[model samples]
Target: MTTTAQPQTGRAEGLASRYSTFMSRHASLMPTFAALAILILLFVGAQIYFGNFITPRNLSALLLDNSYLLILAVGMTFVILTGGIDLSVGSVMAFTGILCARLLSEGFPAIVTIPVMIIGGGAVGLMVGVLVQYFEVQPFIASLAGLFLARGLAFVVSLESIKVEDPIVLWFGSTRFRLGEWYISPTGILALLVVAIAAIVLQWTRFGRTIYAVGGSEQSARLMGLHVARTKIIAYVISGVCAGLAGLALTAYSGAGYPLYGVGTELDAIAAVVIGGTLLTGGRGYVLGSLVGVLVYGAIQTVISFMGAEQSWTRIIIGILLLVFIVVQRVIVARSDRRR
Candidate 1:
């Protein structure tokens, strides 16, 4: 009787332990949920505090204005999820945008120019990933070099803002579909499509699991037969391609490409990813968190404008929040590693 009782008790404790572990591991997602709640509250408060805030026109402007940021955030989420960073994204956007504009001006047509830009961006990102993963180069230093190279390419492509003369291309960036009082936009739709695809890829595929494994522990992932280097490299390439497409959209929305655009945007994308609950030290987080992060960022920008504050405050606010979350993530990850 004593032995039977002991076995039953041991099984109960094992079940409880598994439950606890699952809950704790998933608790990292709580911050992202909190961020989303706060963002909604802020948006509502802005509507109440500022009479003009809720107009369909103003809301549309907000969504359309930040489409590129939205796209880039998705890519950044992947990089952060894998315990890495890519600072050259902004410059890469500039490079792709200018290249697309140049092709459009030279009569390459919309279909060819757009894909070329996106592919070029991915290629550049792949090169950077190769250096970081195989050549053992630090991400910061390698991306910094990439930044300069991309900027140089942008300059070489166009000394002036080049406009796309293709009507279809312009419409893709500017046209809106009406839905009664609330309108849908090309840019917003594109952003949503990209997010959905990224979510599915991250959550459902073998490649996605490899990414998580690689991020969770590089050495362990390698021993377990994961393609850790290839996974990281692909993450970077995805980011680059997304940023490139973003730049292409920017050109359409603005009707021109200038080399100086997207200079500080990569930082904004990184901050949004972190704020949305991604661990900077890596091994945890999701693409949906990035969507929430983009909304939070846009809400903050909107609120700051409503408050009549300097635009620079956006950077300060993001920087402070980023520091706080990063420290918390480091502490959590460190403790978990010790337990393991």
Candidate 2:
């Protein structure tokens, strides 16, 4: 009997050891897991508090409203992953919107105007990246300069809001597909597509791996023969392109391009990224996490509206959530370091 008990105990210990090893191996994912839990809780709480919060129409509206921000968050995700910030994204978004409006008003077709806006946004990011990588400028300083340049350019383009009267642009903005009782706008569709593409690029591509490598340690990345400069530049380019796309989305959503649009928008994007479980110092995050973060944001706003509180409360709630997430991230990072 004793010998039989001993064999069973050994087997139990072996199973426990394997489970512990698996947990340790994937420990970095803890923050993302925690974020997911928080999102679910907030979502459920909103539905419970607001009788109509789970309605399909309202949900669709939430997606439509946040589509642009989601796109911006995707771009910002890449830059942040590289342990850098892009303060220019918000300004770039405004510039792109103004540029699109100017182009469309000047009789440029959607096909031409759309691509130009995106490329223009990418160009701004390219400039910032070049300043950071080639000129050895710090990302913060370079992006700050870019922010001012983009805003100045937007004001130069137009002092007042430019209404988009283009038939194609208006049609794109108005068109929607009905799913059951819910309608999804083209902007929402594009947002989902961008998230899917970004997820794949970040998870599977060589460039994506290089991004992580560079973020982990630029010196180590160079020692391993990774093109650190190019990777960094490309991240900014991605961010710029995303900002441009976001601007276009916003233009469609609101049917106008205001030079002052997206002021402080960078902070929102950063908040989303941070809440999504991405480390500000870089080297650990998921594109899917960012998407969930966006949803959490939308859900919070919906909750506030359902409660009939002031709209300003939305910012206050977001600030509190952002603070909590940042604290969680710090703890996760410290624990990870300790494990190492």
Candidate 3:
């Protein structure tokens, strides 16, 4: 009897150890699940509050309205995973939109204008990365400079909103596919494609692993012979390019470009990233999580709109959620430290 009891106790201890290890390994995923849970709850609440909020038409509208934001969040995820921030993404979006609008107004084809916007945005991102990696500039300051430069450039291009009269641009903005009772926009497809590609790059590629390593610890990453500077810089470039693409999506959605279109957008992206479970300190997060975060954001706005509440409620709710996620992250970091 004593021998049997000892074996059972040992087995229980072994199981407990395995459970702890598993939890430790995947703890970063908690915030993502939390975000997902919040999304579901919000959706349910919206349905309860507004009766028809769960219909296909409303769902499609949510995707269409927030496509640009989803794209921006994907790029922001890459930067945040490296424990860096890109404040310029919002400004880049505005700059790209304004530039593309001007070019289109000048009779440039969509084909030409699109690539130019992407390249230009990438250039700005590269500049920010170079400043941060080579000049020893802080990420915030470097990105802030980028923000100012991009915003200033947008104003320089035009101080007023430029209407996009190009046929292709208008077609993109107005065209929608009927799926039974729901309508889907081309811009929404673009946003989903960006999310899928980002997910693959971050999860499967060598560059993606290097990004995680750098974010984990720059000193350790260098010791492991990773291209820390290149990875970090590329992250910013990806962000910039995404912002540019988002600008195109915005142009398609609105049929015009305003220099102030993406004002405070960077903050929104960061909030989505953090609320999605990406650590502000860097290293452990998923791009899919960012997608869910975007949905949550869109859901809040949808709920507010359906409820006929003032738009300010969206920001207020998001602020409360952001604060909650930040506290959760601190708790996660504390647990990780305790484990180490």
TM for every model, in the order presented, reads 0.90, 0.93, 0.94
lDDT, each prediction: 0.85, 0.89, 0.93
Judge candidate 1 at residue 252 and give its lDDT.
Answer: 78
Which ranges of candidate 3 are over 4 A from the true structure? 1-21
Error of 2 at 244 (Å): 0.4
lDDT of 1: 0.85
Highest-lDDT candidate: 3
Question: Rank by TM-score, descending?
Answer: 3, 2, 1
List of clashing residue pairs for candidate 1: none
For model 2, where is the 10-residue window of minimal lDDT? 26-35
* Model 1 misplaced regions, further than 4 Å: 1-23
**What CA root-mean-square deviation does each model show from the true structure?**
5.4, 2.6, 3.1
User: Which candidate number has the best TM-score?
Assistant: 3
In candidate 2, which residue pairs clash?
A: none
Residue 335, candidate 3: alpha-carbon lDDT: 94
User: 1 or 3: which has the higher TM-score?
Assistant: 3
Model 3: ten consecutive residues of lowest lDDT: 166-175
Indicate whether candidate 1 or candidate 2 has the larger lDDT: 2
